[model samples]
Target: MRALTYHGAKDLRIDTVPDPVIEQPDDIVLRVTATAICGSDLHIYRGKIPMVDDGDVLGHEFMGVVEEVGAGVRDIRKGDRVVVPFTISCGECFFCRLQQYACCETTNDGRGAILNRKAITPPAALFGYSGLYGGVPGGQAELVRVPKANVGPLVVPGSLGDEQVLFLSDILPTGYQAALNAEVGEGSTVAIFGAGPVGMMAAACCRMLGAERILMVDQYRYRLDFAVQAYGVEEINFEECDDPAELIIERTGYRGVDASIEAVGFEAKGSVTETVLTAAKLEGSSGKALRQCIAATRRGGMVSVAGVYAGFIHAFMFGDAFDKGLTFRMGQTHVQRYMVELLQFIEDGRLVPDAIISHRMKLADAPRGYEIFEEKQEDCRKVVLTP
Candidate 1:
């Protein structure tokens, strides 16, 4: 089988690899139908996260058809269409019960390896990543071995397509979680940083949650354009505005946004932007966006961060959050928790997540897809690779 492998920073390739098989009674082997690239995958491409390295298959957002199942996997069978959660949880763990599957003890952080097992050392172990998570092979291939499939839901709804349900694995649920964390409510005003795929999806969820006004911010014109044209959202070009927060406040008549969702993650800005401390903060535009989110948030409002972050940050001021009594909720989206609700939305025709998909290609062209998404070329929102 040909799989997309990560070979350090800004390097990737399509390589022939052994096909994945069901290794345990609870496991299942999936013939991947469609897989999408995620923003977290960019961390490995930039070599910022823990264990990214060459030869690691690096995709987590995927939907597929079951080719085989382990003996204990009764709910799912060969030929079932499914979407595997990015976080592979054992279902019986404490975190799984709490709907925090990302933190499950048996969860594999993109690496298919079960927790507590030993494998050859790699950069990170995320599905296609190399740092902290085990560098297990990912679904951006012809076939993938899913460690726990029974717990992972398969969408059998008659109305949904693979494109719409594919996002249920990661971004759709993630965006829903972001809106939930933001506490979007009836007539509430919300501001979301980064109009990327996740950010846009969050806006859609926010609208569904009854937010009266949704402020979508991004430096890129095309993305913000998509936000407004697709969802009837208000766009804010950070580049054009002298202060996004001030503009948002003006738009809301001096009451800042009721909630803010920071979807740019580590690209969030630092508390202070001095030359010496700039490098000490997060790597990308997220750091800058975080600063804007804090400034834009209304007093006592919530800030939900769903973007990826690594390690610590410099010049971070907890003082602002404390003074304003801001509620901060940020972490990996517990995708398993919201899968059902998101799928139902798809079934009801209220949400169409596939609108964010900008590019599609065969698994062999996975590297090119990564390049296009990384460079943000040609209004690329999400890239899907078919095996």
Candidate 2:
């Protein structure tokens, strides 16, 4: 089997590895069809995600066909097409019943803290991520071993395309979760900080939720243009104006938007020209757009931080949130909670997630796909790797 292994910062490769097998009665093996390169994966690529290690397979967003099922798995048979949720979960846990599958007790321990801890054994593990998590190996390979197959649902809807259903693994559900977090309503005004695939999807979901006006913020002109021409979203390039918040408020006639989405993850900061990456200061948050979001949002509005934030976050003003009575929602999106409905949305032709995928390549060319996405090449939104 060929799998992309993580070595170090900016180091990854597709190498032949032993094929995975169903280890437990509840486990199942999947033959990878299509997988996605996520913004969260970038954290590991940049060496910012400390848990990753040499020889660890790298990928989470994926959809595939079931190859083999363990004895305990009865709901899904071999050859069933399914979307793999990024978070491996056992659906019978207390948190899962509460619609919090990300914190499933049997698979993910102690509210996501267990995965981030440096010292956990095989009984508690995470796929693809290194030591910080469970290090169970990822899906960016020829085959993936699912720990809790029967409970995972392995959805098979006849109407949805594989490309469309694939995003349900992470970003689509995440975008839907972002809108839900922001409490986007009919005729509401919404602003999103990043214009990447997830951001664009958030914009699309906002539109579906009946937002009258949608404002997308990004430094890149191509992304801004895409938002406008493709989705009828309003674009705001932060570099063009001195005060983005003031401009957004002005555009909304001083009422400000009803909600804002933060889609940029660790890369959420000033432009490369402004970010001084010294040894002492590896990463620092100017948080200009987020601050602008707070300022641009209507009083009592909702601010959803869907962007990935690891380790420590700096320069966020707690006072501003307190003074404005802003409702702040932030976390790794609970994709399992929304996958069913989002799959229906895709089936209904209401969401076009596949349109955002601009690059497609084989597993052998996966590294090149990473480079293109990292460079943010013109109009590059989502990159897909086929195994």
Candidate 3:
């Protein structure tokens, strides 16, 4: 089998690798049908997350047909079409009981390993991610071995194309969870940082949740313009505005946004200092978007973060959050909690997940797809690949 492998910073390749087989009784081998490259994957691609092994598979968002199932997997049978969540979880755990699948105690192997090596506690194992997770082979290949198969993979019964359900594995659920964390409701005004795929998806979700006005913030004209055109969202190009936070405040008559969301993870742009800090290994990420998110939220408002942070930030607005009584919610999305509802949304014609795709290619062209997405080339918003 040919799988996309991460060689090092800014280097990815298609390499021949052994096919996967069911290892655990609850595991299953999936013949991958479609996969999408996520923005989080860029963090590893640029070596921002350095714990990745050289031969690790390079994807997390995918859907496939079940080729084989372990003895314990009874609900899912061979030839079933399914979309697996990125987080591996045992549905019977305490966290799973609370619907917090991302924090399942039984799947913290990656967190324990990372704590042992770097003294940094990570979340549960993420597919195709670094050793910070379990180093589970990702879905960006011909076939993949899925753990916790009974609870992780959602069986898709519709005749819908893979693109419609592929995002259910990651970004769709991630964006929906991010919006849920913001607590947006009727007449609420929300400001979300980043016009990337996740940010826009959050906007769509907020709209569904009855937000009156949604502000889309980013420096990229292409992305913001797409968000505006696609989601009927208001645009806030940070480059055009002197101060995004202040502008948002002024537009809202000084009360500020009712909810603020940060969708830009680690590699936030717009600051030379943060860039230097990142390159020098002096800071975790730019954190500029988060700073703006804090500044844009009204007092007593909620600030939700869906963007991933691989390390600690040197500076955070703890004082501002404290003074404003802001409620902060962040974590890896408990994808299993929302996959079914999102699929229903798609089936009902209320959401069109595939509208965000800007590029499509074969699995072998994954390197080029990664380059195009990382560089924002050709107005790329998202890329979907097939084997």
Candidate 4:
């Protein structure tokens, strides 16, 4: 099988590897049809996440057909079209019962190593993610072994295209969760930092949930402009303003935005030197976007973070957030919990997830796809690869 593997910083290759076979009674082997690179994947690509090893398969956002199933996998079978959640979870756990699939206790085998390094318990195992989670082989290959088959793979009707249901694996629920965490509703004013795909979805979701006004902030004019045009949200290029928080203040008539979303994680627009230093293991990740989120959010506003940050963020304004009584919500999305409702949103003609896709290529061209996506070249917002 051909799949993209991580070699090092800024290096990925489509390598031929062994085909997958069923490993557990509840397991399924999926013939992956479509897979997409995620913004979080850049953390591994940049060597900032320290979770992957050389030759680890790279990819988490994908959908496929069930090629085979284990003996205990009764609800799933061969030829079933499904979108597998990136977070591999056993549905019978206590956390799973609470709809907290990301924190499932039984899924991750990498928690010891993760806690040894970070001093915090790890989340559920993630496909194609680094050893810091589970070192599970990702879905960006010809076939993948899927665990917890009964719980994680959400079956989609055959009529819906892969593009429509694929984002439901992660970013769709992530964006919707961001909005829900912010507690945005009718007549609420919101500001979002980072105009990437998750930010775009957050904007769209905010409007769908009845936000009265939406403001998008980003350093790139192209992204800001893209979000503005796509969602009818006001845009601000941070480079254009002396202080972006003041723009939020002025835009919301001095009250600040009612809520804010942090969609730029480790790749946040901060000092290039510091980001490089951090990536090189010289310092910590910068909290440039989080600072901006706190600065732009109104007093008592909710700050919802959908971005991926692994370690301590330097210069985080905890005091400011505390002083302002701001509510902060941050975590990986519990994807399966939100999939059904969000899938309905798409099936009802409310969302076109593929709008974020700017490039599509064969799985053999995955290396190039990663390059374009990581470099943000060719106005690329998203990249989808077919295997």
Candidate 5:
């Protein structure tokens, strides 16, 4: 079987690996039809994510046909096409019962003790993320073993192509959750940092939830322009502005936006001090985007983060957030909790996630795909690979 594997920083290769088999009663072996390189995958590609070893299969956004199913697996059967959620969860856990699938306690195998020691009980095990999140073999392959199969794989209608339904695995639901957490609604004003795929999806969802004004901030002119053309969002190129938060505040009549979202995560570009600190391991992540979010949000408003942050950050501006009475919401997406409803949104044509895909390549060409995406070459927004 051919699958994408991580060799080291900026090194990804399509390797022929052993095929997967059902390893648990509830497991299913899927023949991957389509898979995508997520922005999060870039974390691993850059060696920023700990515990990703050489040859670890890498990818989470994937959908495929059930080639085989374990005896205990029900609801999904052979030949059924399904989109597997990136967050693997046991539906019987306490958090799962609360519909917080990302917090499922039984799937992580307790290997996240490093993170657990930091008072953060690691959440769900994710496909191909890292040892910190359960070093499960991921789906960027010809075949993948999907655990918690009955709970995670959502069966989609044959009428929908893999491209249309693939993002149910991660970014779509993530953006939706970000919007929900930000309390976006009719006539709401929102500012989103980062014009990447997740940011664009957040803008689409905010618009759907009836936000009247959406401001998208990014350093990339192409990405910002795409957001404006696709979602009718107001674009602010931070590279051109002295201070994006100040610009946002001025645009909103000095009240700031009703809510702000940070979609760029730990690797966000920041000041020279922050960059040096992050590179030297003095800070866990750059707090630049979050700072902008806090500064651009109105008093008593919400600051929602869909971005991934791993460890402690230097000078996080907690005092500012406190003084403004801001509400903060962030975490991994409980993908199972929202997949069905978001699928309906896709079916109804209310969300067009695939519209953001700027490149498509064969699975064999994934190394090139990763290069272009990581480097932002050829105006890349999203890349979908077919196996």
Candidate 6:
């Protein structure tokens, strides 16, 4: 099978690898029909994510037809088309019982113990993320072994194409969860940083949930313009301003937005000090986006983060967040908890996840796809690959 593998920083390749088989009682072998290169994959591509070795299969947003099912798999069967959630969880765990699938305790293989030292339990294992998350072979290949099949793979109707349903595996649910955490609702005001795919999805969701004013911030003119055209959001080009938060606050009548979301994660553009600190290994992530979120949010409002951050930030503005009584909510998306409802949204035409796709290529062309996406070539927004 040919799949995309991580070689090193800015290196990805299509390699012929051994096919996967059923490895557990609840596992199913899927023949991947469609897969996508997520923005988070860039972390691994840039060698920022630790523990990813050479030839590690790399992708999380994928959907396919079940080619074979283990004896214990009940709800899903052979030939069923399904979208697999990135988070692999055992449905019987305490967190799973509470619908917090991302916190499932039984799936991490003790690799998460390192984070336990910091009083933060590592999240559930994710497909193709890294050894930190179980290092499961991802679905970027022609075939993939999907564990916890009964729990994580949501069956999709034949009426919807793979493009329409693939994002259920990750970003669509992630963006939806971000909006929910920020309490977006009728007449709400929101400021979202990052106009990438996830940011665009969040804007669409905020509008669907009845947000009257949505402010989108990013350095890319094309992305910001797309957000305005697609979701009717107000655009803020951070590159054009001295401080984007100050601009957001001033534009919002000095009250700031009701909710501020940071969709750009650890790799967000930062100041010289933050870059130096990160390069020196003193900071785990850039606090630039979070700082903007805090400074642009109204007092007692919510600051929701859907972005991925694996470590500590230097000079975090926790004091200001405390002083403002701002509520903070962030985490890996519990994709299983929201997949079914969001699928309904897609089926009803309330959410058009595929509308953001700007490029489509064969699985063999994934290296080029990654290059264009990372370099923002051809005004790329999202890239989908067919195996």
What lDDT score is found at residue 229 in candidate 5? 91
lDDT, candidate 1, 342-372, per-residue tens: 7888888899899888998888888888889
Question: Candidate 5, residue 346: CA error in Å?
Answer: 0.9
The C-alpha RMSD of each candidate to the native structure, in angstroms, is 4.1, 3.1, 1.9, 1.9, 1.2, 1.2
How many residue pairs in model 4 have overlapping backbones?
Answer: 0
lDDT of 4 by residue, 61-112 (tens): 9999999999999788799999998998888888899999998878887862
lDDT at position 295, candidate 4:
88
- Model 1 residue runs over 4 Å out of place are 108-126, 268-286
lDDT of each: 0.79, 0.80, 0.88, 0.86, 0.92, 0.92
> Number of clashes in every candidate structure?
25, 4, 0, 0, 0, 0
Whole-structure CA lDDT of model 4: 0.86
Candidate 6, residues 51-71: lDDT per residue as tens digits?
Answer: 888999999999999999999
Model 4 RMSD in angstroms: 1.9
lDDT of 2 by residue, 1-387 (tens): 999988888878999999998899998899999998987788788887665668889998887888998999878888889987877777776777877776665774322332355653222235676665567789899898988876564566756667978988888988889999999989989999899888988988999999999998888898888889877888888778777788889999887899989998656666454266422365443465677778888889999988876443455667887788899998766777898888778878899889887888898888888878888875677889998
What's the TM-score of every candidate structure? 0.91, 0.92, 0.96, 0.95, 0.98, 0.98
Which stretches of candidate 4 lie above 4 Å from their native place? 112-121, 272-283
Clashing pairs in 3: none
- The local lDDT score (0 to 100) that residue 28 gets in candidate 6 is 97
Per-residue CA lDDT of candidate 5, range 258-376, in tens?
99999999999988998888888888889999999999999999999999986768778999999999999999999998999999999999999999999999999999999899999
| Model 6 steric clash total | 0
